[model samples]
Target: MKRVVAVFRQQKFEDVKRALLAIGCEGMTISEVKGRGRQLGVKESYRGSNYCIDLIPKTRLELIVNEDDLEDVIDTIIESARTGEIGDGKIFVSDVEEVIRIRTGERGSKAV
Candidate 1:
């Protein structure tokens, strides 16, 4: 099993969610997060004053999937989240040792 963690532009959340669902992903955890990458957030001007936002708002989506579905899930997220611009965000994949359903006591891939 694997855990896919994607952090992307907030505006692209709907697109990413839809694409994931279309590909048969049944569940995921979504969060509103603040982070900075190499771009280091952004700058803005107001009333002749300039300011830097060191932490930019982003959307985070996390899901667990079988090894066979890892590539597809990553591709779907990228295709939906890409904006060809800086701050478009990133994806992280990690090994998942196990998954257990609290209610049904299901474990492993079946629980996922």
Candidate 2:
């Protein structure tokens, strides 16, 4: 099993979620997050003053998928989350040792 953590622009959350669902992804966890990447956010104006907004709002989507569907899931996220510009987001893939469904006690891929 593998865990995919995809962080994208807040505006792209809905599109990314829809793409994941379309790819037969059963479930995912989404969270509103604030952080900065390479650009370290941008400058903004509030009223008559200009300020540096260091932390930008983003959406984090986490999904555990079987190895067979890993590529498809990543591709779907990348395609849906892209804006053809910087700060579009990032996707991190890592090993998942275990997964257990709390209600049914299901484990491994079935739990996903």
Candidate 3:
């Protein structure tokens, strides 16, 4: 099993979701998150004051799927999320040892 964590600009969430679904990902969890990357956030001016906003708002999408499906999922996310600009966010993949569905007690890939 694998856990895919994709983070991207808030505005690109819809595009990423659509791409994921087109690639056969039926389930996912999305969250609003704030983070900084190499460029280190952005600058904002409020009330005539300028300040460095080091923590930028982003959308985080997480999904768990069989190992065999990992590559397709990653490709979908990357293609959808790419904007050729900074703050496009990142995607991280990791191994998941096990998964269990709470309601049915399904384990392993069945739990997904």
Clashes of 3: 0
Candidate achieving higher lDDT, 1 or 3: 1
TM-score of each model, in listed order: 0.97, 0.96, 0.93
After TM-score superposition, the amount by which residue 1's alpha carbon in candidate 1 deviates from its true location, in angstroms, is 0.4
What tens-digit string does per-residue lDDT give for candidate 1 at 48-79? 99999999999999999999999999999999
**What 10-residue stretch in candidate 2 is worst by lDDT?**
17-26
Against the hidden true structure, what lDDT does model 1 obtain? 0.95
TM-score of 2: 0.96
Instruction: Choose 1 or 2, whichever is better by lDDT.
Output: 1
The residue-by-residue lDDT of candidate 3 on 15-72, one tens digit each, is 9988888888989999999989896968889999999989898999999989889989
Clashing pairs in 1: none
Model 1 misplaced stretches (Cα beyond 4 Å): none
Candidate 1: deviation at residue 48, Å?
1.7
- RMSD of every candidate to native, in Å, equals 0.6, 0.9, 1.2
lDDT of 2 by residue, 13-41 (tens): 98998888898996999899999899697
Q: Which pairs in model 2 have colliding backbones?
A: none
Question: Which RMSD does model 1 reach against the true structure?
Answer: 0.6
Q: Give Cα-based local distance difference scores for all models.
A: 0.95, 0.93, 0.91
- Scored by lDDT, the top model is 1
